[model samples]
Target: MPTLLVTASPHRDEALGNRLARQIAARKGGDLLVRDLAAEPLPPLTVDYARALTLRDPLPRSNATLELSERLIEELESTDRLIIATPMHNFGMPAALKLWVDYVLRIHRTFAPTPQGKVGLLAARPTLVIVSSGGFHRAGESKQPNFLTPHLEAVLSTLGIRAPEFVYLEGLVGRRATPEAMIAEAVAVLGDAWY
Candidate 1:
């Protein structure tokens, strides 16, 4: 499968989420496209880009922002599977990942606005989200609110990605478990899901 791996962690080599995503991609064994958001951060949305989406006319590709948006959408559309590895930043998505989301969630390109509501235009695909956090944030066990998962779910659903699977590596700062142990558990969980 053609896998698109989008990683947003600033930790680089030490990011467990990114490491796990890479391992999953390797196991899937296909053409891998890695978008390291920290290494190459996307620009924040400009007023022109926002206005372009609202226009009834086709978006002008001549605009640099629109061009980048189109390219990001194309990457998402071409992927057979998508893996997003990110660290939860202050109970929500990091700036880089949110920027990527802004670019990909185009008005006429990825979704259509209807009288009832916005409708997704893209096909649903296999998507996995790997989220890391310094504290526990898994439903009932959460010590704090988790805005990241809900936001991502809604955003991906808007782009026609239904029920994307999520894996969490929490309590890294608290050291509830060693990094190796946590990763092994996560890997085992994934293997079980696939097999």
Candidate 2:
């Protein structure tokens, strides 16, 4: 499968989610395309851009945001699979990833309005989300809000992607934590889920 791995971890070299995402991609024989969001941060969606999107007006030739938005959407549409590897920052994804999502999930491009409600235009694909959290956020162990998965699932589903398969590397802040154990477990889960 053609896989697009969009990573948002600031510490790309050490992010366990990225490591496990790579393992999953390799196992699936993925023709990998990486979008390093931390290195190349997407601009926030502006009111003008949002207006343009809603009105369906073509931007001028020099509009950088429009150009980038089109490019990102093109990449997403071309891929048959997607993996988003991100660390939990304040119980949500990083700003760069959020900006990327803002750009990609546009009306008339990836989705459309329906009488019942808005519906996705893009074809559904297998999507995976790998998250690394210093604190435990899994069900029953979570004290903090887990806004990341629900937000991502809604946005991805809105764009016609399936509800994502999630892999987590959690409980890294505690003294008893062994990161290696978590990494191994997440990798094993990826293997089972994908293969």
Candidate 3:
């Protein structure tokens, strides 16, 4: 099976999610492709790209905007399992990661609009979302609004990926939290899942 690692943490060594994603990918043992959004940010969604995907008539072959979107689509379609490593930023996804998501979830490439509603085109698979936050964002202890998991789940599910496995590393910001301990806990969780 083909596996794609989508990493978006600005933190290189310290980013817990990115490290966990790498560990998971290494253990899973399949064809691997890594897209590091922080290293190479994708172009934000533009009108030209949207026109290429949604136009009534086909656009010219030489349009660079369409080409960019097409490349992004190919990356998404070819993956069997997807691991998204992201740090929750200001209660949501980082700008680079959000842009990458926008690029992949194209109109015709990932979904089709029906009379009833939007339907997903891609095949369903196991999507692992590794999230690290400075504060707690889980059930009763959340100090922040978590748009990260919900937004990511909704977007990926819209493209036919369902029930993403969420692994969270939290409480790194407060006085009492140790990032190393949090990382150890997160790694233990990963060993239980997708190993």
Candidate 4:
């Protein structure tokens, strides 16, 4: 199976999310395509781009503004499975990852607007999200509200991805357990179901 691994971590070496994603990809054993958003960040959407998306006419393949969006959508369409590895920023997802989401969640391309709501056009696939946070965000132990998971779940659902499995590496800042230890434990749990 083809795997699309999208990583959004500023820290290259010490990022637990990225490490766990790579481990998951290795265990899955498939053609891996990595999109490191931190290394190659996407530009913010422009007004022209926004207008173009609302047009009834088809978007030209040569349009420079929509080129990246097109490519991102193509990657999502071609992948058998999708993995997003990101660090929570300000209790939410990183801006880079959010930009990626904006690019892929194109109207009339990935989804269709309906009277009821939005309907997804893309085929559903197994989606795994590896989130690394400095503090606890789980329901009972949370010191802060987690806007990342719910936002991602809603955004990805617009593209037909349902019930994405999330593996969180929480309490990485002040916790007694080492980050490495937390990552190892998370990986062990994932191993039981990821295969």
TM-score of 1: 0.93
TM-score of each: 0.93, 0.90, 0.89, 0.92
> Candidates' lDDT values, in order?
0.87, 0.83, 0.80, 0.87
Deviation in Å, model 1, residue 4 alpha carbon? 0.4
- Model 4 stretches with alpha carbons more than 4 Å out: 56-62
Indicate which candidate wins on TM-score.
Answer: 1
Residue pairs clashing in model 2 are none
lDDT of 1 at 163: 85
Winner by lDDT between candidate 3 and candidate 1:
1
lDDT of 1 by residue, 1-195 (tens): 798999999997579998888888888797999888999989888877887987677565668898899899888888888999999999999999999998999887899889988888888878899999999987677899999999999999989889888888988897888888999878776734332
Worst 10 residues of 4 by lDDT: 56-65
Look at candidate 4 and tell me the lDDT of residue 68: 84
Worst lDDT run of 10 residues, candidate 2, spans 172-181
- How displaced is residue 30 in candidate 3, in Å? 1.5
Candidate 3 to native Cα RMSD, angstroms:
2.1
Error of 4 at 191 (Å): 7.0
Ranking by lDDT: 1, 4, 2, 3
Q: In candidate 2, what are the lDDT values of residues 54-93, reduced to their tens digit? A: 7656565566777789999989888899889998999998
Error of 1 at 96 (Å): 0.7
lDDT per residue as tens, model 4, 106-156: 998899999989998888998999998888899889889999999999998
